[model samples]
Target chain A: MKVAVVGAGSIGLLYAIRTQEAGHEVTLFVRREQQIELICNKGIQVEGESMMYDIHVKNIMDISGAFDLIIIATKQTHVKKIVELVKVNEIVAPLLFLQNGMGHIEDIHEIINPTAIGIIEHGARKLSDRTVAHTGVGVTRIAAVTMKQEDLIIYKQMLESSHFPYKLENDWFEVMSDKLIINAVINPLTSIFKVVNGEVVNNPNLFRIAKKLCEEACDALGKASVEYHLDRVKKVAMQTKDNHSSMLEDIKNGRRTEIEGISGYLLKRANDELPYTTFVYEGVQAMQQMDRREYE
Target chain B: MKVAVVGAGSIGLLYAIRTQEAGHEVTLFVRREQQIELICNKGIQVEGESMMYDIHVKNIMDISGAFDLIIIATKQTHVKKIVELVKVNEIVAPLLFLQNGMGHIEDIHEIINPTAIGIIEHGARKLSDRTVAHTGVGVTRIAAVTMKQEDLIIYKQMLESSHFPYKLENDWFEVMSDKLIINAVINPLTSIFKVVNGEVVNNPNLFRIAKKLCEEACDALGKASVEYHLDRVKKVAMQTKDNHSSMLEDIKNGRRTEIEGISGYLLKRANDELPYTTFVYEGVQAMQQMDRREYE
Candidate 1:
């Protein structure tokens, strides 16, 4: 399988390395001149607690090529631009979005063929543009929105052989909903509070806010509610005690956050009567606005 | 008139200088050894927008004579200590509390003769210890819980001669209630948001919170209500748009805030039905606790 890892961020780099280690030809599509140079010069270095690997890398926009799978692992705010870059470059493949937050599926469907699969790839950002540590081996579920079986099966075989946990779910909405719950619960709070994920455990106020926000999102989605979202959210915050959320990463790096696509979105999507959740969302939004003003 | 200004902070220095300029002998009480040495050697320099004056200063515990008016201008947390110092020094006159908030009256009453007057002196903090800009020429209202005619006349004459727009109110409780309303509305919000008194006008959410808190406080006092307390609170926030609240000053200086003395007192004093205000109080307390843990 020929895999093109678009954006070439920590997540993209990790995926490229795993796929290449499984004997698949992996190509890294990166925009920044420095990232391309570094990856090409040093290859992709992925160091986890127990595993380490280096894989092939390249600048996809510069090179002329097509691949079996194209993973969109850039920040959510960069999704539209990456999509435009892909469309303008005329690179066609089954694109996988591994960014945090929800509602990127519609954007992908609009830009490219509806042959994209969204994956909630959870790990840790070891550092900025340097190394990515696979903190925990979590199951990655993938499903075809508008793709056929042959392509799906071929990609599944490659993913399974890569030694990274991967699963297939026809109900990708459920998976996406689950991921949204976790991200909404952890990302904004950890980012806004400027604390590690685990600090939410001792901070009762933060824990309550996280749980309430998650329930709000679940209520907005109108799906079969899972009673365990709160526990799962708490567990994730506790498990990743030392790690900052992706939003916090953006804040630390002085980049735009995906707050609009997460809590901001939930507030707009949720009904007007949900004042408790909406109040929390609005408060988070105000804090985000403050950050934006401070940075600008 | 003989006057002693307790707590040689910016406000204390201002009162001492103005009293001295009005031809009264004024003594500023210092707490710390360094403050005492600094003030005694260099004099308390009251640098305002218009003029600068060096005030004659003395330590509170070092004073050997009584004063006609003792103005306490320390942060609310230091009130009890100042009262104790005043009691030990045997300076028994009308000790007017020049800080905002509603809890100091009881504390001062318990420690001193019931003749201590509660003052609501509002203005601005323009700089550090050396300077204070008088933004508004507001009246320094003094009401004696219990006082002889000689003491009352002396206190009133001292304030009037000092060019301070002051008046004596028969109902001290009403005057204190009005100031409490203002402080309950403005202090926590300005401190928590880290905004100036005026910036709350631009942030409607803050304005709403401030108004709601003030209304809750007014209801708690059960006073002859004025429609303008809300307007006055909003006007003050806008008027001192660039100035930090005393509570914010405490936070910035890493001093323990008067949370328990100000908004905390209002919340504790209000009936159980005003849970919304209680919620705001708890929120402020939570932030204060977090700040203590973070800063300390």
Candidate 2:
């Protein structure tokens, strides 16, 4: 089986290495030409693992050939661009999106392929252009977005391996919302406060704010889901205690964040006032707009 | 005129030094016995001044004598405690309160003393126990909280000098609200973003949030006050660009912030929903709850 992972980020790199370990040919798609040079030359180094895998990597714009599975692991902000460039034989290939937030769910209709929305519970971090870390081990859960049960099974069997496990959910909306709630709570709070993921729930002050965010997010979903979402938020935060959230890393490195897709998306979906959501949405946006190093 | 300035903080030290420079007998009432010891032993060293004044400094608990003027230079959070401890001859010693926010305004009625609320525009930082740096020069504006105009004039003349000046406003409510609005926009934003006072407006990202905060603050005030308040926010932010806001300084040192008096006060007075105010209020509150140094 051939797997095409359309991102060279933490998740993309992790999946590319893991899928190859499962005896599949994995091609890692990256946005930058520099990442291509570095990855092809140095191969890829995964933390805690002694060996480096000399995996094949290419620019997303130069992607070609048939893939048994295509995983869109880019930040939700870049999903649209990936779809525009990498829409090759979508009818035959099963499209799986592992991007954070619910923004790409809207764009799933653009591909005529069998699509599945996946939530990567595994904690992964891109240490550098050619290095990655599997910070926390968790299963990948995918739900059929447009794929039928039979088609889903074929791709699931090909994608899931012993070390790189996968779980399929019946309801795509439910699983994605669960992930969305978790991301909405953890990402921006960690980003704004400049703390590791664990502190969001571990610190009492942050927990207070995190709970408020959870409640705001669950408002649209109704109160029934509040406890469940809040519990997941706390659990995931602690599970990835030391890892800097992707959004926090973005802010720290002066890159654009996924606030637009996470908190921003939730803000737009809620019918009533989402003061907490709106505050963080604008807060993260404000962070994206300024480079504090100049002041320093 | 003999003057008593309580609290050894930036404002307290500034006023104590300036009052002495005006040829007034000044006693600095500090909370810590250590501060009293330090100030009395080595005296205060103010930035840009060559001579160190061996000024009279005493513990706040040891406060005595009927001073001609009593100024509460403590934080708004400490006003109640100061009022509780130093309930000196309020009627005779015209008490002028120089603290940020309107939280202390409510406690003024508990005293029979002629009280005036003042907004200090001077950018002062206590570099050490007894040393302070006057980073920016601005006037002190006072409005009578309980005192009559005639009594305010006496203290204004006694306290104001060539280096330190004072202005009087007719309506204390308006001036205090204007200051509160400025504080609400500047304090928490600077504190949360960990930027200096000027970055709140000078940084485009922060300026966006600052504008929203000013609008939410002026919501109950109506549209007439929006531009005026925003212009003031920007002007003050730029004027004090090099200076860290008191709230920012408090957070940095792990000291208690006056968020309760500043953003917290405005939040309570607001009639409509203030997303920006509530966000910052809770954000600063959360900051108070957690010490990130443990995680560090």
Instruction: For candidate 2, give the lDDT.
Output: 0.82
Query: Compared with the true structure, what per-residue lDDT tens digits does model 2 show for residues A218-264?
Result: 88655576888889898889888888888888888899988888888
iRMS per model, in Å, is 4.6, 2.7
Give lDDT: candidate 2, residue A119: 86
lDDT of 2 at A258: 88
Docking class of 1: incorrect
Deviation from native of the Cα of residue A246 in model 2, angstroms = 1.8
By TM-score, the best candidate is 2
TM-scores, one per candidate: 0.75, 0.90
Distance from true position, residue A184, model 1, in Å? Answer: 3.2
| DockQ, 0 to 1 scale, candidate 2 | 0.47
Clash pairs, candidate 1, are A198-A241, B197-B237, B198-B237, B198-B238
- Report fnat, model 2: 0.47
> How large is the C-alpha RMSD of every model relative to the true structure?
5.5, 3.1
